[model samples]
Each structure stands twice: as C-alpha cells, then as structure tokens.
Target: MNPFVDIILRSCTVYFFMVLALRVFGKRELSQLNSADIVLILLISNSVQNAMVGSNTSLEGGILAALALFVINYLFKRWINQSKTVKDWVLSKPQVLIHNGNVEFKTLAKLGITSEELDEAIREHGVESHKNVKLAMFEIDGNISIISGDNNLKQTHHKRKIHKTLNEL
Candidate 1:
C-alpha cells in the first residue's frame, strides 16, 4: 500500500469507529452533562489516536482524520434534517418542567433533575418565584427558557400607555 493511501485508510477507520461510538452513546445536552460525560468524551479522543496514526505517525494522518470527521458530521446533519423522525431520535424534544406556575415534578425527576437544580436554573434566569412564570421549558439543548406571566401584562400595559401618551401629545 502507498504510504499516503495507508494513512487515509487508517484515518477513515478511526473516524467510522468514533462516529459509531457517539451514535451508540446517544445525545446529551450541554447543561445536562455530568462528570462522567466529560470523561467519556476525553477518553474517546485518546482511544482513537493510536488507531488513526498507528505506526504511520505523520502530519498527514492527523489532517486526514480531521477531514474524515468533518465529512461524517456533515452527512449526519443532513440526514437529521431530511427526516423529522430521525431528528427526534437524534435530538430529543424539549421537556416542559413548569406550566401554569406548577412544577412538573414527574418530568423533572425523570430527567434526573433535582428540586435544588430546578431552583438554581430558575434563579439563574432571574426569576424570583415559579408563580411569576407562565411557562418554563427545559430545551433539548439543555438550556432553560422562562416565560414570565407579567411579560404579557407588561406589554399590554405599555402599549396602552403609549397610546394614551400619544393622544395627550
């Protein structure tokens, strides 16, 4: 085998194994990541290094592995976009943790989120209390979205006040 071709083949094999491992492990939201998740990601790179370079430790091997990874990621993105079911399977739907100012304890528990964690999330959003919130969603991407009950009322009042001021002017 030509030296360059051998490098390419090895790189491709490493890329394939990495992608397969990632798919099998499933998706995890950034905010939802624990210590174990971080360790697994770190280990993946270390484990694949030998397979990618092997006895052919060269700059070209590293470049080829990076290129193969990019190509695989691009194809995966396109596949997810082309099918809604695939998208759902790859990226889960957002879970509603709070609705009508009531905490969905069951949902939160299922997500492995504790009450303290929920409170911290809400506090990070600058919300004083759950009652002040209309809807609080835990997005699939692991971010919290808090929709305040007062926001609608404030908007309505602001519009009315603007109209009154315009009339007076």
Candidate 2:
C-alpha cells in the first residue's frame, strides 16, 4: 500500500476507536478535566501518534494523517446531523437529575454522580438549595443544566473545567 494511503487508513482507525472509547466511557468524561484526565488525554495522544503515522515521520505523512482525521470528523458530524438513528446511537439522551425540587437519586446513582457533586452544581448555579430547582438535567454533552423555579426562572449550564473537592470550594 502507498505510505500516504496507509497513513490515512491508520488515522481513520484511530479516530473511530477514540469515538467508540469516549462513548463507552460516558459523556461526563467530556465536561470535566481534572489533573488525571488531562494527563490521560496527553498520554493517549502521544501513544496514538506513532500508530497514526507509523515510521513515516515526514511532514507530508504527518499532514496526511491529520487531513484524514479532519475529513473523517467532518463526515461523522454531517452523518450524525443527517441521521437520527446515527445521532441516537452515538450520543446519549440528557438525564433528569432533579425535577420539581425532588432529587432523582436513581438517576444520580446511575450516572455515578454523588450528592455532594450535585450540591456543588446547584450552588454553582446560585440556587440556594435543590428544592429551588425546577429542573436539573445531566446533558448529553456532560453538562449539568439547572433551571430554577425562582421568580426570574434562571437557567445555567454547569460546565466544569476541573473537578474540585467540596472542601476546596
């Protein structure tokens, strides 16, 4: 096989594997980037670089690999947008964590979210307590979206860049 073609194939394989891995790992991994998460991402990228380009470390080879990844990514996004079945298969539906001031404990447990984390997210949204929340959703993109039943009907998306312990907050 031509080296450029090989590079393209390898890059495409890595891209799909990454998408599958992220889907299997849960979308929460997308929202928060703790120290360990950053480290893992960095290491994974480094480890996959060789697999993508193989022994051909020339600039053209590297660019071809990146071009392949970009093309596949664009195609994937287009396909997902065009096909409901593909979108559903690739992404999870948002989960309701709180409704009408009631905490959805089962949903929290299923999503591996702790009470403290929920409380933190609520506080982040400026809601004094979960009782004031009209609806809290665990979004498919790994964001905790809070809608308050307060007079203003405020809504907030809790997209945390880094995980913080309760004590640290």
Candidate 3:
C-alpha cells in the first residue's frame, strides 16, 4: 500500500476506534475533564500517534494523518445528522432528574449522582430546595438544568466539575 494511503487508513481506523471507545465508556466524559481525565487523554493521544502515522515520521505523514482525521470526523458528523438511528445510537438523550418538585431518586442512582450534588446544583440555580424546583434535567451535554416552580419561574444550568463513574457508584 502507498504510504499516504496507509496513513489515511490508519488514521481513520484510530478515529473510529476512539469514537467507539468514548461511546461505550460514557458520553458524560465529554462534558467535563478532571485531572485524571486530562492526563488519560494526553496519554492516549501520545500512544495513538505512532499507530496513525506508522514508520513515516515526516511532516507530510503527520499532516496527512491529521487531514484524514478531520475529513473522517466531518463525514461522520454529517452522517450522524442525517440519520436518526445513528444519532440516537451515538448521542445521549436528556434525562429527567426532577419533576414537579419531586426528585427522581432512581435516575440519580442510575446516573451515579449523589443527593449532595443535586442539592448543590439546585442551590446554584437559586432554588431554596428540590421541592422548589419544577423540573431538573441531566442534559445530553452533562450539565444539570433546573427550572424553579416559583411564580418567577427561574431557570439555570450548572456545569458539573466532577462525575462519579458508574463502576465507582
């Protein structure tokens, strides 16, 4: 195989593999990055560099691999946008955490969210308590969104800095 073609194929393979890994691992990871997350990401990038470029360490080889990644990513995004099935499979749907001042304990447990975290999110949104929240949702992007049941109907979003992995919880 031509060196350039080989690089492209390798890059494409790495791209798909990374995507699959992220999807399988957890989409919540995309929303926030802690120290461990950042370190792991850096290490993964370093580890995959050789796999994508192979023996060709030339500037051209590196550029070609990056180009292939960009093209593949663009095409994948377009496909995801066009196909509902693919979109549903690749993306997470928003989860309702609270409704009508009622906390969804099952949802919190499933998502590995603790009551303290929920309370913090609620307080950040300026709601006195969960009972004052009309609706709370764990959005697809991993942020907690709150809507207050007050007459003013305040709404707010809180970006979580830490997330407990499902295995840990």
Candidate 4:
C-alpha cells in the first residue's frame, strides 16, 4: 500500500476506535476528567500516535494523518448534527439524576455517580439541598445540570471537573 494511503487508513482506524471506546466507556468519562482519567487519556494518545502515523516521520505524513483525523471528525459531527437518530446512536441521552427535589438513586448508581458527588455538585451551585433543585440532569456531555426552584439554572461554567479528586472512588 502507498504510505499516504497507509497513513489515511491508520488514522481513520484510530479515530473510529476512539469513538467506539468513548461510547462504550459511558458519558461520565467525557464530562469530567479526573486525575486518573487524564492519565489514561494522555497514555492512550501517546500509544495511538505512532499507530496513526506509522513509521512515516515526514512532515507531509504527519500533516496528512492530522488532516485525515480532523476531516473524519468534522464529517462525523456534521452527520450527527443533521440527524437526531444518528446523534442518539452516537451519543448518550441525557439522564435525570434528580427530579422534584428527590435524588434519583437508581440513576446515580446506574451512571456510576456517587451520592456524595451529586450532593457536592448541588451544593456547589448554592441550591442548599437536593430538595431545592427542581431538576438535575446528567447531561450527555457528562456534566450534571441543575435547575433550581426559582427557575434559575446553576451550571458549571466549564464542563471539566476541577476540584474533585475522588470521582471514580
């Protein structure tokens, strides 16, 4: 196979594998990156770097691989944007973690989110308690979204987790 063709094939393979891996791993990971998560991601990228570009250390080869990855990603996201069914298939549906001031224990458990984590998120928003929150959703992106009693939304400015150290614990 041509080296350029090989680069294309390898990059595409890595990109698709990562998408499938993320889906199987669940949305909790994509929403917040704990220290362990960060380490895992960094390692995965390092491991895949050579796999995507192969032994072609040339600038052209690197640029081709990068271009192929970006193009594939853009096209996939565009396709998802065009079709809700595709979007649903590719991404997790938002889940309700709390409703009417009641914590959805089952949901929290199913999502691998601890009650302590949920409680901390609620308090972080100044809602006082779960009872004061009209609704809380574990969004498809991995952040817990809160709607309080006064029709105000207390949401994290950044989706990335900053202070939490025991996310998986």
Candidate 5:
C-alpha cells in the first residue's frame, strides 16, 4: 500500500475506535471535568495516536487522523442530540450526594468520592459549611451543584457590601 493510503486507513481506524470508546464511556459535559476525567481524556488521546498515524511519520498522516476524529465527533454529537435514549444514557442523571447538611455516605462511596471532596465543592460555591447547604448533587458531568439554604442571603449581603464599597471608591 502507498504511504498515503496507509495513513488514511490508520486514521479511519483510530477515528472508529474513538467513537466506540466514547459511546462506551458515557457522555459528560466539558465543565464537569474532574481530575480523574481529565486523566482519562489525556490517556485516551496518547494511546490512540499511534493507532491513528500507524508507521507513517508524514504530516498528511497526522492531518488525516485529526480530520477523521473531527468528523466522527461531529456525527456522534448529532446523533446524541436526536436520540433521547442515547442522550439519557450518555448523560447520566444527577445523583444527590448531600441533603439537608447530611452527606449521603453510600452515594459518596459509590461515586468514589470523599466527604472532604464534597466539602471542597460546597466551599467553592461560597458556602461556609455543609450545614449551610440545603442540597448538594453530583451532576452527571462530574460537577457538584450546591443549593444553599437561607444562608445564601448572607453571601448576597456580603456581595452587596463589596459592590457598595467599590462604587464609593
């Protein structure tokens, strides 16, 4: 086979494998990337590169692989949008990890997350403590959504104070 044809074939194979892997791994939103998720993405890209370029070191091989990946991803996204079942399965439903200031230990364990991680997530949302959170959910995309109790009003007040100071300045 000509080097060009070999490159194209390798690219197609890698693109197909990527599509299959993505289907198997389930879909998650980009904003929801956690540490583990990021590592998985990196590993997948590195592992698939050789499969995509084969033994060809030409620029055309790399370009072919990249283009193939783009096309496959575009088609997958289109299909996911049109199919409800596929959407649901690919995008997992949110799981409640904490409720009414109490951590759901079972759920946490199942998600392979620690209470400390949960606490950090809550804090990132500006909640002082878990007690201030009314609801905390682990989104399918690996993000934590925190719904604060009336304590959010306190945060609002703090924000207002800062704005007022800035305005005066």
Candidate 6:
C-alpha cells in the first residue's frame, strides 16, 4: 500500500469514527463548551494524531492526513445535501422546547437541557420570561432559538444572539 493512500484511509476512518461517537453520545455538550469540553477536545486531537499518521513522521504525511480529512468532510457535506435519507440519518430534527409560552419539559429533559438553560437562552434573546417567548426551538445545530411576542398585542419579537463563534452547533 502507498504511504499517502494509507494516510488518507486512516484519516477518513478517524473522521467517521469521531462523527459517529458525537452523534451517538448526544450533541448537547457541544453547544456550551466548558473547561472539561476544551480539555477533552485537546486530548482527543492529540490522541487521534498518531492514529492518523501512523509511522509516517514526515511533513508530507501530516499534510496528506489533514487534506484527506478535509476532503472527506467536504464530500460528506455534499452527500448530505444530495440525499434526504442521509441527511435525516446524519442529523437530528430541531426540537421545540417552548411553544405558545409553554415550556415543553419532556423535550427539554430528553435533550438534556435544564429549565435554567432554556430560560437563559430566552433571556439572551431579550425575552423577559417564558410567557414572553412565543416559540423556543433547540435547533439541530445545537443552538437555542427564541421568538418572543405577545398575542394580545399582536406582535412578534424574534431575536438571536451567538454565545460564541462556533464552527458548528
């Protein structure tokens, strides 16, 4: 087997494994990164580096591995866009956390989100309380989306604020 081809295969395998692990373990923790999450990311990257490069310590090997990972990710995205079934299997549906000022406790619990987190997201959007929130959705990308309004007033107040610059939710 060619060294570059081996690097490409190894990188692709690692990428798929990481994606599957995150998909199965729940993506909630990824929304809000704490100290532990950062540490976990650092450690995982360091550990996976060896698995991707194997015995090839050359700069070319490292570049090939990285390029392979990028290409695999690009292809995966394209596949998801082209296939509805693939998209559905690879991604979860957006969850409705609050509707008509009513918090869906079951959905929140299922998503491993606390009432406090929901409330915080609402407040971040400038909603005074749950009653002010017309709709609150936990998006598939892992961000809380809140739309505030008063039915009596016949108004809509939808606001979104990014907690951090994230590559993905």
lDDT at residue 113 of model 3 (Cα atoms):
82
Q: What is the lDDT of every predicted structure here?
A: 0.68, 0.87, 0.89, 0.82, 0.71, 0.80
The count of residue-pair clashes in candidate 5 stands at 0
CA lDDT of 33 in candidate 4?
Answer: 66
TM-score of each: 0.73, 0.89, 0.90, 0.85, 0.68, 0.83
- Output the lDDT of residue 46, model 6: 98
Estimate the Cα RMSD of every predicted model relative to the unseen true structure.
11.8, 2.2, 3.4, 2.8, 8.7, 5.0
Candidate 4 clashing pairs, residues 3+ apart or interchain: none
Best by TM-score: 3
**lDDT for model 5:** 0.71
- Candidate 2: which pairs clash? none
Task: State candidate 3's TM-score.
Answer: 0.90
In the predicted model 6, the residue pairs found to clash are: none
Q: Model 3, range 37-151, lDDT digits (tens) per residue?
A: 8898999999999999999999999999999999999999999999999999999888999999999999999888889889989998888999988889998888999988676
Give residue 85's error in model 5 in angstroms: 2.1
Off-target runs (Cα >4 Å) in candidate 5 are: 1-12, 19-44, 151-169
Put down candidate 2 lDDT per residue, 87-138, tens digits, no spaces: 9999889999999999999999998888988998999888999999989998
- Candidate ranking under lDDT, highest first, comes to 3, 2, 4, 6, 5, 1
Stretches of candidate 1 exceeding 4 Å from the true structure = 1-26, 31-35, 152-169
**Candidate 1 local lDDT, 1-78, one digit each (tens):** 776666667777776676566667665655455566779878977887777667767787777767766776787789
Quantify how close model 3 is to the true structure by its C-alpha RMSD in Å. 3.4
Clashing residue pairs, candidate 5?
none
- What is the overall TM-score of model 6 with all chains considered together? 0.83
- Candidate 3: stretches off by over 4 Å: 163-169
Please give the range of 10 consecutive residues that has the lowest summed lDDT in model 4. 157-166
- Most accurate candidate by lDDT: 3
lDDT of 2: 0.87
